[model samples]
Target: MKKYFLLVLLLAGSHVMVAQTKKNGVYTPDNGNGTFTNPLMWGDWPDPDIIRVDDYFYFVSTSMHYVPGSPVARSKDLVNWEMLSYAVPRYDEDPRYDMKGGNAYLKGSWANTIRYNNGTFYVGFCTPNTSRTEPGHFSICTAKDPKGPWKRTIFKEYMYDPGLFFDDDGKVYVAHGQERLFITELNADALSVKTPQKEVYNNPAFPYLEGSHMYKVNGKYYMMGSTGGTTGRQICLRSDNIYGPYEAKEVINDDHTYPGNGLHQGGMVQLKNGSWWFIIMQDRGPIGRVPNLEPVTWVDGWPMLGDKGKGVETFKKPDVGKTHPNVVPATSDEFNTAKLGLQWQWNHNPDDQKWSLTERKGYMRLKAGKAAKLSEARNTLTQRVQGPFSAGTVEIDVTGLKDGNVAGFGVFQFPYAFVAVQQKSGQKSIIMVNADSTVTTIPFKGNKLWIKASVTHIGYTASFDYSTDGKNFQKIGNMLNMALGLDWTANRFALFNYSTTADGVSGYADFNWFKLKDSL
Candidate 1:
């Protein structure tokens, strides 16, 4: 009996590794080989505000209406990180469903998250609706916690993208606006302004739109923000005054070479070796926004990018002094533990009343919610596409996956193509893959099941199995060629779930794990 039990355990593990199939899921960062080009961070990680605190570097980015918003990512070596938590105040939480990029009613905050003057951390962001009613702009939020019940502060009418700075002299100032860049002084607390705001600088020399982060180096102050449209246009600026004669300089140009430089609010941090590095953002079209770390040096007393400079057309990792061997984490999951990891995301707007994890069923429970006719990848409830050229498997034990609606394991190319293993109440489990809405479905009616799906550069395949001894398996074949009819629409890798049934509804499912495999 002991031998039989051991065999059963081995088979359960083998279910994910029966064949050494080369699949696509583990994405390797560009080692600057020129064959591939990729930003250091993948998917909607715009307006990065990073700080080096001790050996641990902390970064917080824009929420833009995605729920459990204001995701804070932590890193030790600067190259890799893990999602920490949303820094927004949870009172009106669940994520904004306002007229945002994803449909959240309240677009939480925009840019510039900073930690300064001892342990006080500051995040600068815009909540659109507040200032819109007053004039031409939105209200900005200032918070002490990267994850916060923040204090929303609106300074002026018709202004957006507010940034705060604490000069070495202990003076605090606030800067923001559109068409023309603006700046004003905030009292000591760095919360409210003591003076009327004024124009700092404006140049048709740039689009002069959202995403502005300012800092002082030597004796000059530099202002960096996004220009042109918020999607792919970006650059940087500098001045000697808190309010300028702000000199607009081209850091990353809007061109084919490094095309995706989208949201451009960022600055430099000093490492233990005293070398400097900066974090910038660029949106990878359909894959959404992501951050990129660039190595920088003081040239001619001004700043210049190092080996991999400015707008990068080719993919490569920044020469951030030295590479810390271990940084990035495993993208897969096994539900053996009770807590859901921080890497998951919910659809456009989340109604969490329908989901739970009580340890009773040993899996995630997703009760049905009023399903909107939502297709935008942002609205489907997704997470960052883990890596570019990698493979992984999503395992779901559907023996008890049931609800008035459907639940499944799916690989998503957001706002569009997705393939899922869905189960409906009193019905056989089904496999779904689609490009637009034209879906192909397969059925499986079984209990005590182990389902695994593998991915590769060529595409992906889903398999189902039942084992009496947990080994020497009987196979269930209904494979999917993700490459065929696969939506090549630019997408970040992600895992997703949702409800199409109704509002005030309910559902549940048990996902075994999601395992990521590396080719190299």
Candidate 2:
């Protein structure tokens, strides 16, 4: 009887120590009790690659078709992250990157690798061919600082899921491809491949193996990659040689319980205290792919994640000397500075003449150039939409808008929806372009209006409302089914202004602020 009572007490205590950490209507890793949760980042930051440099932890992720691409984030504690820089800032190699001749939607850098060698930080990624005729390109960007004035070098060959590794012998090599991983030597400058590529490992068990990141730990070369696609699993391969007779194992999965949640496509890092953690991404529906930090333990020369090779939802925080305040990626923008907030990203390469912060002090003035379709609008600014229950509010001043101009706030994705104020022949009215091909228009007499978009549930349903008085907002459009589009990306909170004419005319709108609120 006493043994049974003691066992019950011990189980209850273990449950208390292993509670999940969450915050603000979303999953937050930092628990404030020296423990954190599964998803270190709540929003869509897919295919994360993390590296520790001195006291700072630098993170890189895939930015497929967004400008200022290959996002780099810095963190003191791995749980709290801030936007740092973009490895590929301009995407200048392709004209489609600027949305000129064609659109590079759903095609940009994928599964970038971030490495710190000697004194420089290197980010390498491959841009896949959007079409069969156009070939893909691989590029490496290097910088002294993670937040950088990075210099990009585009190579001719395409290396899918490229992993940059600097061996102890001072040799640079890249591990790339799927089904069979290949290793090729690079020149000292890492500008281009020098040697013929060799097939190192062929995973017969895991067929679609990619997202490979090379790491040398304790004189052993480790190649970590994800397989099984969207409903995937993370695997780790270890070898004594850089080019190896490698042995592989699946390190972590969803524990085979979380429906549709795949634990795959992320990088691992060792903390200053010699503790290891893996930050991998999971497909979380319309909110897109989010990141989760799993505790890793090295057992018998292998890194093990979660409980007995299963991903954990909560765990003890890394012993990084101190705790960090819970932080997610930046969202709200006040438009108070000459430079735009790190949260805002242009849909494509922006037209320099079409957008300005200095023209109207303390406002983002987006000049609507002659673009008849919303997809062609050049200066549309956007930020990711947080999951569960989150709202985006923007204040727009329409006093400077030209005739045949439409200025509004929207959910930017395939099959998107928006509520906007359109001005034609000096007459202004509110119009809604809803998801279901329905258009609702109402006469408007106001010069300034506050627009709000609220996403509810599992990031699928969204509704738009507008207010002339900023306090009383009325619903303006039908609810948007905010699913992950055919493009396979998250819906974004978009603010845009564009002209309907193709006569080289321009109209503009001034945005005072963009505020975000996440329900607790």
Candidate 3:
């Protein structure tokens, strides 16, 4: 009896270990031991900027053209993170943001900077000039808390890839520009420029130098930036004066984690335990630019990243004094809440009258908006597709859809695709739209349907499936070979409803729930 009991206990322990290693049926970086893996969160969290406020670490990332732009997250141990809020509530700078005469696909917010000073937090980013009518500008947001009722100030000047810095004497300055770097002092208010821009460091060796993150450590000023675009390397500059004759070095130029794509363009933060870590991004094809957390060691005066400048795949977690529960960004949503989940973001600015979570009680109602193509559709909700493999499934009610309406779920990118239910001339049919504008149709008469998009990072492919009953799903479309277009973003899972015609009473589709898993 004693021998049998020992065997049962051993088997139970093995099961618990396996369960702890995964979150929501997805492989997490946290190994449940003391070590963790790279690509920290396993998604397209690009242009990351991290700051340590007391015992907590606050993170912000670039969210171009996505309403509720610039996502923010908080972590206690740096390995475990939770989605806190967004710094920019919406893009109110131009009419294009609303998809009025045009669209802002890759031109909203880019390369953001986050810093904390004297009980106030600041996030700064730039919007590029899209056309003659829509000019580019810089915007700064301030709040006491990261999860904020943030106050925003827009400036006419376009400061590309800004790095907000606070000097020892309480002077504030912004380091910005593309290949040619410049530093401008901010007024006491830290809202507008107080001094004219000065050329700080512009070396021909480091071309395409941008994403500046300025820091002052031990009386020496350091400006960290990335060169070589997406396939780039991290460059660091050291100077006695904030502006001037600086020494430049290639701090990190490695792509061991994801070969051929070097880690670059992110900021560093000092933990409460007095250790430093660099949060940089690695471009992983169509899935998007994912962030990697690397250890930082100060050699002489320069902060070297990774294991002697090579990328480390697995390393001991930063000793934040204690272990925290494993957590990943929330993905699955039941549409039971008054508002959409933090993971969800509109492709551009959404039409206020088009989408609602309260109208159907437990469903998210998306009214059809007129659009020539899915790329131009408004109120199209999206979230990042996870790495390795992930499947996003949604239960949608097509009964509410009207004629000329199309509603379904699929991968959203430059060359996107979806498996949707199309209603035309009072007839309904299930159709699969490929990335190359090819469509395959099959007649369908169903009120409720479950649609899914399965994405795999290995081959960078996305395929679609659908089901009348929730338990079983049938494959629909040919495999989509995803590619990174001019959007400068990873492919995302999107839910959309739009009208092909500009007439009649446009209807809506109700999404009951969105569930994510490793596979079907």
Candidate 4:
């Protein structure tokens, strides 16, 4: 009987493994065959900067407008990654962070440069303005642990893509700019830069050269930046001195690839075994900028990405001493922890009193304040909508909800779609809303609701589905053609609760879990 029970457990685990591998389920890059595929991460991990600290690899990426911005992820092997921490926990400096009268939108934190010097980890990023009068703000975060209680230093002047480098001689320098690259020497604390910023490199071949990350590799100062555009090619400027007459070369391009996509805007890291790898991103339409791990071959001090200077769909895994289980960025929160999952980000700076995980013990309670429209909704917890194909399903209990409260799942953006349950007086109805404010209402009598938003790569459409029993699901609303063009970076699956009535009135929705699946 014990043997039979063990066999049954194994079968159940096998079933779960099969289910997770379903199309648009949890996407893992590791192929389990000593090799891995492109997209080291599945979601919109744009402007990736990777650094090796001891045996672990740390990665940081841009999170425009998403509070708890510039997420730091860790990995044993480059293929598998998990969220370690966020460098900028909150945008406390500006009122717009909380979406005051204005929204940050596409103008929060931009590309981050993460580095580990001695014992502390440093992350530098620039926050651009959403409105005039405010040009931008440059900031740096330092932490003993990458998973941090980070100390931040905000600079009044704007520096685009501020790359921080700690020189071997103990001096710190920053390389930043758009049209022309400037190298400024930082003080001993690395909190501020000295005047008379030296112009190091400028665009001669690739126009609009920016996203500079400075490094001193093998006794040579190498300034790496992307050019042409955001979706351009990777270029490297090398010089023997810190500031110099730098020679440039286009190291990586999309000349040979399945998608023929421009691979750019990422950093390089050499593994313990001395083998180098370049982690870069390519814009994949509505899916946003997804990362591709390309093997780097340094030929005569020049690093070439992928095979003979091009992106490849599959490549040999980084030789990081040991193998790790196939893992993607965190998603599918069960809402059982004291804090929300690291995968979840608020659309903007969230109201602290508005959301909690302890309110319902095993659920996330999103309390709604007054909001006239979905665009005005605050405290909307969101996760990046994965691509190729993916489905995000949530089990929300509407029992605690009051009248004038609308709570459920959303494909959140300017041109977005949402399938939510609305409460009025005593009646509870499920409604699907399109970007143009078109609504499809369904009378839902039950307090327990299971809603799902499924997106397919075929038509690049997202469809809504609702289930009462968590088994049989009925399709509702028109299929939403996912917008590739939005002011924001990418569309996200958001679980929101907001009141449509007076500001004082409050109602809440308890989300039990969010399950996401991604397919090829």
Q: Which model scores highest in TM-score?
A: 3
| lDDT for each residue of candidate 3 in 1-520, tens digit (9 for 90 to 100) | 0110011111212331112235766557687788887768778888999999988999999998898888889998878888998888888767888999888889877888999998999999988886788558888999998899888899877788999999989899999988899999998778998997899887888998999999999999999999998789999999999997788988999975565788999999998767899999998788788888899999999999999779777789999988888888899899999978999999998898999999999999999999877998988999989866789999999898888898989999978999888898888899999864757899988888899999886578898888999888888869888877756788999999998887623689999999887752
lDDT of 2 by residue, 264-326 (tens): 888889988888988888886777788888888888888887777777755677789976767
Top lDDT hit: 3
For all predictions, the C-alpha RMSD in Å is 8.9, 5.8, 5.4, 5.6
Candidate 4's C-alpha runs over 4 A off are 1-24, 255-260
Off by over 4 Å in 1: 1-38, 89-106, 129-159, 228-234, 254-265, 272-274, 308-325, 372-381, 390-392, 399-404, 411-414, 420-425, 429-438, 447-506, 517-520
Mind giving the per-residue lDDT tens digits that candidate 1 earns over 1-520? 0110010111212331111112123333333222223345544576777777777788877655455556677776666566665665332532335323334433455664565565666665665554444442333455555445555554454347767678888778766777687887767777666677888877776765556767777788887676766444545677777877776665654322233334355656777777777777654443345566666667665566434344443334434455544334335665455555665555445454545555445555554444432343232344544322233445444454444334444444433344444545566545444434525555666543343333332233332333323345343344433431212122333344444544224444455556655422
The predicted structure with the larger lDDT, 1 or 3, is 3
C-alpha lDDT of all candidate models, in order: 0.51, 0.81, 0.85, 0.80
Q: In lDDT terms, how accurate is model 3?
A: 0.85
User: Which TM-score value belongs to model 3?
Assistant: 0.94
Clashing pairs in 4: 24-517, 24-518, 24-519, 25-517, 25-518
Q: Per-residue alpha-carbon lDDT of model 4 for 237-336, expressed as tens digits?
A: 9999988889998898783332445788888888889888888887765667888898888889988888876687656788887877766677888899
